[model samples]
Target chain A: MQENILTLRDIVVEFDGERILDKINLSIRDNEFVTLLGPSGCGKTTTLRIIAGFVEPNAGEVLFEGQKINGVPPHMRQVNTVFQRYALFPHLDVFENVAFGLRIKKTPKDELNRRVMEMLELVDLKGFEKRSVQSLSGGQQQRVAIARAVVGKPRMLLLDEPLAALDLKLRKEMQLELKNIQQSLGITFVFVTHDQEEALSMSDTVVVMQDGVIQQIGTPEDIYNEPANAFVADFIGDSNILDGIMKRDFLVSFEGQECACLDRDFAPNERVDVVIRPEDVDIVPTQLGIFTGTVESSLFKGVHYEIVVDVSGYKWYIHTTDNVEIGAQVGLKFGPEDLHIMHKMFDGTTNVLQGEVVGEDEIEFLGVRFTRENLGLPVGAPVRLTFSPYDIIVAPEEDRDATVYVESVIYKGRFSELIVWKDETQLILRTQRDEQVATDIGVDFNFDHIKIEPLGEKADA
Target chain B: MKSKVPAYPYFGWMAVFTIIPMLFVLYFAFIGDDGQFTLDGFRRLADPYMIAIFLKSLWLALLTTIICLLIAYPMAYILSRMKLNTQRTMMLLVMLPMWMNFLLRIYAWMMLLENNGLINKLLGFIGLGPFQLIGTTGAILAGMAYNFLPFMVLPIYSVMTKIDGSLIEASQDLGCNFFGVLRRILLPLSFPGVITGITMVFVPAASTFVISQRLGGGELMIGDVIEMYFVGAEPNFNTGASISLVLMLVILIGMGIMNLFDKDEMEGMLI
Candidate 1:
């Protein structure tokens, strides 16, 4: 492995007693372009500020080049920042703004002029030496901010959504320019942005984050093709993730069909999630397709047509060059390699069962007996049993002996949530569907996902 | 009514009060006591005593303006950086004294600085001799600084608060210490406020006869001399008006230089 340039170890941060980043650990290699992609209020900017030493994390160490720099001020660190607003000094001209850091170091006048002019030329602002920073356009000001940051030759550069303020065209142009600058300088760039297109196109590595935790970290292709979980699959790009069961070593069943896949390392009947990219699905003739559906909507997206195909009440977004007329029946075919399997974040079992303590480590519920690690109680003691929602797998009406009545089915943009009632208890599970409310559906889940506790201690409360 | 109705009253007020009074001053400056148009009043400006009074008034005004700026700039800087709620409370306290009559506030200061007054009595309790605290140039300077300080502070505070905080952070990121940021960013950005504050304080301090008469113990400034010409045993309105016109020209020229000094790319963004 290449040498690591920076490492953040167990970094915890809180604002006003609310935890923002919980034990975040990240490492960046030398000369790597890493993008932290997340939504707003996800602590991406806070992480960048912690690296810049503008903010002090309540706990944890920030190591730069194997040296702890917890209390080091920003100027003393070998890192510079290009802020979100392009915080260029309005009082200074372009040349002077770039020359500010060099002047502070007390470099010789001739050398300072040469370096400042060279940096200005790098950013395509060679003749803007005398132009005040306020007179420049948003793109030009961003260039000035970049030039000002890189003129010091810091080991790492931190940019906090620097392209967000620019128009689309300018933002695209600057993204490429910034990537090229980072490569030529051979310095690590920790870029923070909510724009996934920029992250996918510009950076070598993408760190997908949600809330305060990093959901996935991998190369761009790894993050895009093989997302770690549903959150990663939903955030990185357009994906169709549905509930699946690994029927055997190489076969998976989803949408009432068993298909061959390339994933393994699960029990014979283990439940999992399946993510398929929009570009991976091919539109074929209705007879040759594996799953046939009607094209509900078709939008021309410049490069390709984004078609939403409704396959048995499940909407699958497919990007295809073949134009299918709206309301026309179509067929979709995806290869076995296209189906990516992810470990479920939560075991989707929401079962609440009354259990009787049979032994020191065993509990009996629903005429079934199971052993637990910490179910320490006397025999015949009453207990409450529950499970995670992610582990629940929904099957066709004919697949199971017991059926659950759907209480309500609400469709979020990327997926749907089904609150099913069984035995007078509500179990919330996620599926890729437009499943209607008040329907009966068969549900099955893994036995290992179950949790049991004494009746006196309420599980949820 | 037409849109011009409200403006008509203001126009009448301006003509009757401002324009006519200014025209009368000009007329009196150019006319002799015998009712003949002459330059005799202007020539009287060459008198040594009149010139001395004029110089004294200019010096005292300059001193007062410099003192007010020295005290107000730091206070304004501190106030501007405070949270808005605290700043509002502090600003109210700073402006509370201005709501009262100016003469009454001046009299309160006079009582505090009197020889046998509150301050000296408190000092005497500590076995210190009763110092002659009043009837000095320092006393008049103190009064001017105390009276005009808010004028100097408010403008600077307003400008300082409006400065984008990111600019200062950017300066520090560029390796400027606190003092360096102050010199390079804060001071230059607030130069317009400094100019306005100087004009506001100096214009009044330069022409004040009351401060000199009450605090300096009968010292005669140019305003006192102008008053003497207007209300002395033999009043000379011509000389008084001439003196006023000269002082006005001097202030205008000073302001012109200050404007030149403030002209930069940032000036257009300010007032």
Candidate 2:
């Protein structure tokens, strides 16, 4: 293993009495490219700032090259940062900006010119030396910012959502270029971003975090394949969770159906949740094998056909290359090896039982409603739903959705929320389901997907 | 009803509004006894009495500006470096002096600087005899400096605070120690403010009479010289006007040089 370039041990940060990072322990190795990926408000930015020494950690020691840096100022630290805005001095030209650090160090004029030229070449910004920073385009400005920081030859580089301000194509291009630069230079990079794909695509090690704590730290494949917690699994990628009880080694029951799942440290009748990725699920020709589902809705995304099927009155989602018409019968096929089992953190029993008939294009529980857009379901039709025993959600109250009030409406990035009353069950689906002023909704749920936790562990008031 | 302004006439209007007053001053400068042009006013410009007064006024203005700058630069720097609320409160406090009547403030300073006034009384409390500070060039310069300190401070302070502090940090990071940063970065960056403040304080200080009248016991200055020509001596309007014109020309030429100093590249050096 390479030497640990920087170590953050038991780090805690608090702002105005509210905890932003709690016991965050991260060790970045020499020449490693690590990306901290999370949703906004997950304290990814705070962790980056702590490493940069811009903000003093309330509790934790940041060790650089095995020396504790608790009281080190940002300027004195051997870590340099590229701010999101590129923070280039608008008044300075490209040469001046890149030479800024060197100039501050009082290097000889000839050496300054030589190094600034070398840095400009390193960032592929030759002939841009005389151009004003403000006159450079966004991508060029970003290149200059990179040049400015790296010119200092700091031990570690901290990038705080540096590419967030770029357009889509430029952002994608910058990602590849940044990765190339990191590899070529062999420098330790600790990058913070809310973009999951960018982190997965660029980082050698991806650290997924939530609520100020590291949920999982592993290679991109490890994070994608085996998430440490449900939050990590959900945040890293879309994982369909089913509530079930472990019947025995490799056997779990979900949606009132017993199926084999990957074995975990457990005994018989132990509650567990089985997580299955979307692409891992397959739709076969309609046949009465393990279970059969009716096509409730179908959506065609240029590359693949996404169909929502109603299996045993529960809505089951499947993505496929083959197109199936709405209201058509379909077969669900998945090997037992693909089903990953995780014990519920809250309660022993993972299996929960409750579901309702969902329509084709739209799904409805009691009061909870959802549009089956990509699921390829039909409108106002009875659809059979088949999922693992853990998928169905049997809750005392609704959290992700609303009932009686249609009470609140909120717009989050790529996701939204709604509150409606299903006679008695106030249900919430914190899913990327859009429900507008009067959007039709339907839901065919199964016990397999709703991994059950005990009602006692609702967040403390 | 607003009338449609024809284009050519507007240029004529501009000349009438702005150019005629200058021509009037120019005309008054050379008018003779029969209302003809003469050189008596120009000769009076060389008079030893008049020349002495002019030199005194010029030196006094220069002294006042330099003194004000010496005090105000640090004051402005301290104020701009303070927290926003404190900065604003301090600015208000500095401007408070300007809000009072100028003559009244001068009178108050007179009370402070006079032979048996506040300074002497305070000295008496220290077992020293009463001292005299009023009716002197130093007294006039003090009065001028105190009155103009605000004008000098505020512009410099405005420019100083507008400087992006990150530049300083960048300078330090690049190996510029604090003092080096001040000389290479802070000084050049703040030159425009100096120009503005100097222009603001010096112009009024160069011509004001009341400051010298009360503080210098109605002695001599360019104002005294011009007033002597108009109301004190033989009432020579041509010479008086010519003397005023000469002082005016001197001011204009100094401002022209200032404009040259404040050319394009240095214009951007504000802050």
Candidate 3:
């Protein structure tokens, strides 16, 4: 509901012939603290640079209060950046550094002194006027950087992970201090960082991005509660997302059982994804629950116990305050409203169907036979199956011939996703903590989870 | 401590080669041949001819140092900002002439500056007059600047390369134009290097006798006066030692003034 201060439309940037930012469109409102949250190489810093006019986008329009600023240099912009490394002038004292911009404008000496002293006090760096920049600690240097950038009274500020170099405690302290400063100054801040906790705790609007594309843009609560896709759900916090079939308005199927969900508005028997937060799952007695599993791991995570239960081949992560023993039988319970459903996205991983076709409507891939639609191909011909990563479940390794090697595992929050290598292609699968990297694991799937297609010339059909 | 013993060799070398020779100079300058101390050697420096040669030497050295700095500062600035590969190649080119024999290099300059030499031949081909450039203060000044220009360039280039790139960018971001950045950031940060370069060029240029002998013709410098006392027809060790001591004192004072400008703590040595 606030007035937009800056808007970027269709921004594209490339480095060394590789696309770093692709058609990024964003709008920052006045006096709002917007944080661009993403992992490294996600082009978050590039986006901040483009807004500050430090970098030019190959094609885009940067509008500042409805005025184009594409050709404006960094010094000419109404925005200033607190660079990640602080970039303080080593030869200058703290006072001179803070008064640099004012001196450049030929401000009177008395006025410059007052303004610099005011900024130094604002950043809690009083009495540091005569101290050289090189003698300050990392936290003090950060304060000097903030003072220098803000003393100019620019309309907007851009910070490219300014707290990234501080220790954890100092970083936490600076996060709250920076937020308070922004609020007091009423300057619209566009902050860039890879730390999700920093973004969610300090920002008014968190723009979650991945691989140069924005996944979702919302308030912190909106981003935390209702993530738009699997990537967003996996990135923001811990969630167990699995492939499900939305049978109807209030029904979905997963793990060979029908479950209830609040999400709806999908075609009958449409492939979808269901996400349930770890904190939402309640631990019940094994006999009194809908599904039972043994607790494979229990880790003390300060406020709660992060317990992983193995239900057949599926690992369900549950966050509970109660202590549970490992290898004990337990049950996971969640209400219908706890589930979130989203459309499936295929990330271009192929499956090799090496089955001896028994009949016209039956096919096999990864040692699992399925009754599928007619392929209209010869019985002995080879066929390939395509499936989304959301459908693949990462499990413990097996010494069987129908297995692939787990090359790597990346722990997002609750569930860890594995990169498995089968033949020469790599496939990503999200699973539990039962598997290690470089171990051969059996690739398992249910009959209803896969789709069949003809090979070679008839592939598009 | 055991670590202090390794420095004994350096102390011994300093005593034998530097300290003792300096003591002998002082002893010879003050004593007559009768083993008695007198002020005669010091009074020899008050001679008007010797005073004129000393003043001329000081003037020429000052000219050479200024010329070298004027040419070297810009060259070093450009070289230091060049790409690493290009800098190495250009640096090799700058140092190539120094690898040759110093006397041979001076002689090469003599052949080019002499009457009807290679340079005059080229000038005559273009109808310019064969000027008397071989035995003038201008020719000696040119030779000294050429010989010591690398000493000026290397130190300034070393310091210029150490100037942080971010400081320049920060100045620009703080609304500094190119000239403003140079004045506020670049010049002050590299002041130590400039001082070192000035000392490096001026000291050797002020005390050189070989270049004066080859190019000064009849006009004598203080170095020529000292050489005449020690190794020329007169061979007066006392007067020669006194003149050399005075020259050393003058160069030391010049270095002390230069060191004052190098107040910023920096490792000013090139190697």
Candidate 4:
């Protein structure tokens, strides 16, 4: 087994009272290509910055080769980063830019020239060393950035969306080139990008993040085949996620049909999320299928036909090479191994608070009045309000209605679950932003997300 | 092309306001007072007193440019790093004095530098002398630097702000400490702005007569001599024109030398 080259423990970063990274724990192995994959503002770049020593985590230890390097500056660390925009020195030629690190280390003249020439050759720009970086094309500039970063021969290289600025064909070429370079150099690479395809194709391990929290970390194959949650299943590729109940071990029920699955260890009759990849579903004769549905739309997606089927008012997307007519009765067939069962991210049983209807479309909870629609209950009527923990928005103190004191914060894979209290009432909420324990903050509800049920109706159910 | 039509009026304006005036200066420079061609106007420049005055002007202007640059580079760097709103407010404060009349601003500086003015009064509180600050070379130099500081700052600040911040981070990532980044990246990249700032400050300081007249109390710089020959009791437009032509050539040559340091960047800016 390869030794761990870098380890980030409980890393937390906050900017302007907003948490940008929350308790991120990641370990990168030596000579491994790890990609931090997420959309914009997902803190993937921030994680790369922390590893490159450009950002100081608020609360965490950065262990490089098992030695704590939290306060070490970027220049002192044996890590280099290729900036998102390439950040090639505009004043320097290609040769000088690649020689920057070596010159800074005061390498001897002969070796410096040899190393710079080798790096330029590795980047496939042997004769173009004397060319000004400004005059080069975007793809060429990206190559220079990579060469300049790796020429220092740092233990680890951090690339921040370096290929994002390139054209599609060029980006694809660079992806393979980068993977090749990593293998040849045997240097650990921590790359950050929002391109899912790039991450899947290039990285040995993919760390999927959403809103500053690492949703899942696994090998690319594991991340795609056995996603940890609905978010990962949806983010990794096209999939149909539906609510299902785990009837028993290796068996789940969805759409009023029971189907055998590969998942186990769930309580009987427990609610779960079922994920089926669009490409995994097989179209077959109606009598041979586990379930039948009417094809609503069929699109020619080059290599395959993308068919959307209406399975009891729920759309099931399926991709197949076989063409099926629109509005045709089709049978959906998928193996038990294709059905990925995951524990539901949110359970409706929790985050239910009792409130009184104060006005039309208004309900009062925890001494704060919020405007909610379709209350239907008269004034002074009691109601039970249920909302997803993700809907609880934490606001700054000056912008809040009811002040809540944070009691505890648990770092879920996707968000921070907080147990906060106001007066005598305690509430559980989930947010991407990290809040300090024992601190007072303002709380607000996304009114659109609140589900109101009359008190008497809840008793009957 | 129709696109070229819009530039025609500018060409006309250049001819009337710039080209023709330059021609007139050249014409007058070669003409004698008797309306005949003579080398006497150029010969008069060889006098020791005139040469001394010209050299003094050059030296003072060089000192002023160096002083302004020393003060402005760091100031621009700090300003560039400030928050956008704070940077705007600070820039406004830097430019606030320029909104007033130019002569009025110089007069204000004179008041401050006078022996009994606010500066000396403040110095008196610390038991320092009511020093003779006005009517000295120091006063003239101070006035020139003060008046031209914004010119030195504006270009450098604009350039520094336009510098992609990631370059600094990239440099640091490549094992560059703060000073290394500055020396290798910031200084070389901002060279064009420095050259521009030098041009803007030096040209004005070399030819400025008002600051010396107000602060130096009758000291004769080359600008004062040119002013005397043009509009004094003994007005000599020929000599004045010749001096003006010489000054323009000297400035052009100085700029040409500055361009050698950053030929590509200068061309980039021009294009």
**What order do candidates take by DockQ, descending?**
4, 1, 3, 2
Give the number of the best model, judged by TM-score. Answer: 4
Q: In terms of TM-score, how similar is model 1 to the real structure? A: 0.78
- Report candidate 1's fraction of native contacts: 0.36
Model 3, span A17-105: residue lDDT tens: 76678889999999999999987767899999888776899988999999999988766778888888898877678998899889888
In model 3, which runs have C-alpha deviations exceeding 4 angstroms?
A243-254, A257-274, A288-291, A313-315, A341-346, A351-461, B1-3, B31-53, B67-98, B104-146, B209-236, B264-271
Weakest 10 consecutive residues of candidate 4 chain A by summed lDDT: A407-416
- Sorted by TM-score (best first), the order is 4, 1, 3, 2
For every model shown, what is its TM-score relative to the native structure?
A: 0.78, 0.72, 0.77, 0.85
Shift of residue A425 alpha carbon in model 1, Å: 20
Give candidate 3's whole-model lDDT. 0.82
Residue A4, candidate 3: C-alpha displacement in angstroms: 3.4
What docking grade applies to model 1? acceptable
Number of the top-ranking candidate, with lDDT as the measure: 4
State the lDDT of candidate 3 residue by residue for B32-124, as single tens digits: 777888878889889887788898899999999999999988898888889899999999999999999999988999999999889999999
What are the per-residue Cα lDDT tens digits for candidate 4 across A1-461? 99999999999999997778989999999999999997677789999999888889999999999999989999999999988899988777889999999999999999999999999999999999878888899999999999999998999999999998999999999999999999999999999988888999999999999767899999999999999987688778788887789999999998789999988999889988888999999989899987898998999989999898887767788999999888888888999999999987655436887999888988898888888665566787789888877777899858777788775554433455677777777677878896775477887778787888888644233
Residue A270 error, candidate 1, Å: 6.7
Per-model tally of clashing residue pairs: 11, 68, 0, 0
DockQ of each: 0.25, 0.17, 0.21, 0.45
- Span of ten consecutive residues with least summed lDDT in model 4 chain B: B262-271
